[model samples]
Target: MISFSALGCTQINGAEQNAATPIATAQPDLAISGNSTPNTDSPNTDSPNTANANTASPSADPELSTAIFAGGCFWCMEQPFDQLPGVVSTTSGYTGGTVENPTYAEVSGGSTGHVEAMEVRYDPQQVSYEKLLTTFWHNIDPLDNRGQFCDQGSQYRSAIFYDTAEQQALAEASKNEIAEQLDQPIATDILPAARFYDAEDYHQDYYQTHAVRYKVYRFGCGRDQRLSDLWGAEAPSH
Candidate 1:
């Protein structure tokens, strides 16, 4: 069994928290010059205003790029990225493990070496990777080498799974900047991209699907308070 005292919160894997009381970025617009076919790599560059006014031809822009982040519970990570302007979708999942198609039970068992993570599909033009990193750094407790917030265990450790050398450099640069800004040293890891296994269906869109439960868990766990304490004025509005 995991110890909650070490982290100062209840230790439950990805399980929903019990019901309780509730609680509660600048980016440039990219312009699309031509009618380009959308793909994962070639996302439409048009700004939101000119892109799509109707539901039928939404975005009229290119598909967005993706960034995977492992920061404590996937549920906590999803909402922040989802709220960002350029982020198209944030899918909670597992990564950095040797096992393939590992189930939640297996991962929670703590032997699979996988950390709960979120794959963020975002439009790079609308929101630069640097901005995303800034948003991410603010959301997580980078000083917690063991795990994030109230969660404790290797499975809950923080990490950035970079897909390219450029990404790696950007992540490292961001971490260094954070270190300079704060007195405490940051512990978030920077690693290469690993095979990301989509979590169980129930785990998908957790905040929206289980808004009440998520709010209680976040409040009781002290995620926002801790983040505000760490980031101060730099903290993003949640």
Candidate 2:
């Protein structure tokens, strides 16, 4: 069984107590940007000087790159990529669905064929796509196709939606390498990128908007426990 003590904070936070509370920085520091966790636990606000400022802008830089991934909860996926050094931004969104502009309720209800996903925009000059792939594989449990951690259903299933043929090859190579390393069959899908639907505005920077609740949900969901069991000493501590 997975251990509960691995969680950084075992208590439910203020976000669950009041929606109006407006999440400040995540306490006990569970986030990502340069690594898979940010260096600061400051409340998310719009400012040019903020460390993770680019995650808010929808406008793209021709030079930047994009990768879409579904690793269970969109909330959990954002932090790791956000903290990566080369990552320009991470957007919580939906993709690999038949529906257009699917709402969270519709997607969560399993009627929209949509999965909770994140769009990671990065600078290849700072971080290689291969490195990003490595970060992704380690962060998720490729053995679980039914869902990720506590989130159950098709929408929560893990997938790597590649936007380019090169990405597909890289993802497949990464998947094969992981399988060989673990000596087990990998369940993560390597599929063509689909039309991505940006999630609601409020969902952006959710870890910061609802830091307390994010921690509460993460701890209650047994995410870290499972990750520890799977990755052993190498598991990223979310």
Local error of candidate 2 at 221, Å?
Answer: 0.5
**Best-fitting candidate, measured by TM-score?**
2
**What TM-score should be assigned to candidate 1?**
0.74
Residue 30 Cα positional deviation in candidate 2, in Å, after optimal superposition: 14
TM-score: model 2 vs. ground truth: 0.76
**Per-candidate total of colliding backbone pairs:** 4, 10
- For residues 1-238, write the lDDT of model 2, one tens digit per residue: 3222322211123121221233333345444222123324432322222122222232368788888888987878888888789898888877888766566555666777878888988988999899888778778888997888877678888999887789899999899998998899988888888878777665678777666656756777778888888888878875
lDDT of 1 by residue, 88-189 (tens): 878777888877666665666678898988888889878888988987898899999988877778989999988778989999999998899886788999
In candidate 2, how many Å is residue 176 off?
0.5
- The alpha-carbon deviation from the true structure for residue 64 of candidate 2, after best TM-score superposition, in angstroms, is 0.7
RMSD in angstroms between candidate 2 and the native structure over all alpha carbons = 8.2
Q: What RMSD does each model have against the real structure?
A: 13.7, 8.2
